[model samples]
Target: MRGIVLNATLAAVKFAGGVFGNTYALIADGAESLIDILSSLLVWAGFRVAARPPDANHPFGHGKAEPLAALAVAVFIFAIAGWIAWSAIREILTPHQGPHWATLPLLAGVVAVKLWFSRRMTRASEEAGSTGLQVEALHHYSDAITSAAAFVGIGIAVWGGPGYETADDWAALLACAVILFNGVLMFNRALADVMDTAVSPEFESEVRTVALGVPGVAALDKCRVRKSGLSHLVDIQVRVDGELSVRAGHDIAHAVKDALLASAPHAISDVSVHIEPIK
Candidate 1:
């Protein structure tokens, strides 16, 4: 909720300031900020649904909804990028006169705001252990970079001699390119999450190490991992002593779960162990 509020407030300020200052680069940056606002709202909605306990309709709870929201955000970002690109292309073909000197201060102010917001949001995301928030923080960081580029371009247009009037247009074009690149990145991440791709190689190795450490476990046959918001859902098949009692097998599973949680608390949320008697 706090993330959503910050996103909304920053987006509104950037949009209004961008238009008033007549900085296309600034406007594009503002549009990117608006994307963050929309993405944050989508995440907030997903968290609401995901927080609910498992029900008959969803035996695994609604955790997957968060990834679905991420996918939606990716699609929206692509759409915004397309719009920005189209507008920028038009501007390049038929350039407009530069705005008043007042745009310089507005651009500087935006740069400062973006720097502060990105830093604060990144820390909050890490503390919350929210993948959604972390991804949004990355978006904010990108916005700050693009905003800086825009600020520089605005400065050049204001100070550079007569031939440099189109610097703002070129900057806007560059900003659009940055936005498109980010859109592609977000789309791929969303697709991978929805497809249940393997967790990072490091995370997979840690899971195997922990599972193999179980007392009676002879070997690990298979390990699968998926992320749910900030948590991980892990599934593993392990070979254990055939003579062990049911209770013993259960204890082994518990041990594996405990080890994983201790090593990477935010990485493993739920664990499922498949006990296979050693052959």
Candidate 2:
């Protein structure tokens, strides 16, 4: 919600400045911000859906929606990059008046705001362990980069007089490359989450330690942890004394599950335990 509002405000401001200031780069920036509003809304919806409890048709719940939302945001970034690049190229080919000096101050303010917001979002994403939030943070960072580039370009155009009007367009084009690079990296990360990538070894190690501490657990075999939205799902195999009764083995498995759910680094949504009796 905050992101959506901020983007809308920035978009409107940039659009006005771009038109009045005769800056195509500012207009391109405005277009990206406008699209950011839509992407932010999409992320909000994805989170709402992901928070839903398990239903009849979907046993694993709707956690996948989180990464799917991140993927969608990546797509939006790609689109805006292409659009900005094309617009910048067109503006370069056709000469125009240099951007107004006043526009530089506006862009400077935007860069500062975006940088602060990006930092804030980065911390939040890290704390929450949310891939979707991470991508959103990346979006803000890219915005800041582009705005800073525009600031420099506009500065050059303002100082260099008639000959440097096209510098602004070149800066926008450079920003497009950065945007595309970020898009690819984020897209790959989100896709990995969707594909059930394994969680970090350190996390799995913590899981093992906790499970081993449980009473009646002799040893552990295979232990696997995969990311699912804001949480993780674990599948583990345990080796027990052959002499233990079936009920005891079952109780141990339950204990392990409980320990993992309560003590794992990130929330463990589900656990699958297979018991092996060893003489």
Candidate 3:
């Protein structure tokens, strides 16, 4: 919620500054920030749905909705980038007088705020295990860099003395490129999550170590893991001693689950263990 509010405020400021200053780069940057606001809102909405208890229709809970929201954000980013690029091309073809000199200070302020927001949100998202929030943080970080580029362009346009106004168009063009690149990156990441990619190797290794450590477990046969939003849904198969009783196998499985939960509290959402007698 805090993230959402911050993004919304930044978006409004950028939009207003961009329009009044008659700076294409600033306007593009502002548009990207607006996209961030939408992304943050989508993330918050997804989390809200995810928190709902499992019902008859969605036995697995609504966690997957978070990734879907991320996908939507990616699409929105792509559309915004496309629009910005089109406008930039038009401006370049029909050269225009530069933006207001005052926009430089405003852009600098925006850059600073974006940098701080990115760092803080990144840490918070990582700790909370919210991949969506992390992606949004990255977006803000990228915005800062692009906005800085715009600042340089604006500086050149106003003070370069001769033929520097061309720099303004170049800067807007560069900003458009950055926005497109970010949109592609976001799309790829969100698509991977929607496809249920395997969890990180570090996470898999931790799960294996815990499962193998369970008493009476002879060895690990298989471990399959998938992400559901910020959490992992693990399916593991372990080989236990053939002589072990049913109760012993159950206890061992429970131990493995508990150990995994303790080891990676933020990552492990649920664990399902299959016990097979050692051959």
Candidate 4:
């Protein structure tokens, strides 16, 4: 919420400054900030939906909404990158007067804010285990880089040699490439979550250790883990004595689940344990 508000305000400031100062780089940076606002909104909405409990229609809960929103953010970033690149090319072909001197200081301020925001967001994302926030933090880092480029663009336009009127355009073009690269990375990460990639090796090991500690009659067979937003669901198979009664096996399964939930580091949504006869 705070991020959305701050980015929106910055977007307005940069766009207005760009028009008055005749700086294409500032305009492009402002457009990126506008998209940043949109991305933050999508992330907030995704988390809200993800936190909802399981419903009759969706048994696994709405946790997938997080990755879906992350994908949306990546798309927005791609669109902005393409637009910036196209505009930069046009500015390069038809040279224009350098930016007004006032735009330089304004863009410098933007770069500073983005740098601070990037660090703050990175910490928050790590603590929350939020993929969307992680992507947004990287986006902010990219924004800081591009805003620095914008600052240089304005500086070149206002103070460079007579033939360097297009320096700002070159900077904008570089910013566009950075945005595109970051967008692709963020997209791949979000897509992996959507595809139900396996949990981290450490998390899996932790679960296995907890499962083994439970008082069971035999060996463990298989373990599978799937992520659903901030939480995960687990499925395991265990082998017990062939002569054990069904109720006894059922009780053992519940005990394994309890032990795992009590010891696992992450929030586990559910656990399914399958009992097999010890061969």
CA lDDT scores, all candidates in order:
0.74, 0.90, 0.79, 0.87
Clashes of 2: 0
Q: What is candidate 4's lDDT per residue for 208-249, written digit by digit as tens?
A: 888887876477789998888878889999888889899999
Instruction: Tell me how far the alpha carbon of residue 149 in candidate 2 is from the true structure, in angstroms, after superposition.
Output: 0.7
Residue-wise lDDT of candidate 2 within 66-141, one digit each (tens)? Answer: 9999999999999999999998999999978899999998998999999898899899889888888899999999
Leading candidate by lDDT: 2
Task: Give one digit per residue, the lDDT tens place, for model 3 in 67-108.
Answer: 788778778767776776677778777767777789989888
Error of 4 at 262 (Å): 2.0
- Ranking the candidates on TM-score from highest down gives 2, 4, 3, 1
Candidate whose TM-score is highest: 2
Ranking by lDDT: 2, 4, 3, 1
Error of 3 at 73 (Å): 1.3
Clashing pairs in 3: none
Candidate 1 lDDT over residue span 1-279, tens digit each: 665666577667767766887667667766777777778898778767766767899876777777677678778767776776677677767757764467777767767776787788779767865555555665676677677777777788878846666677777667767766876776677667668777889889888998888788799999998877667788999989999999998998888877778878765767888899989
RMSD of 3: 2.0
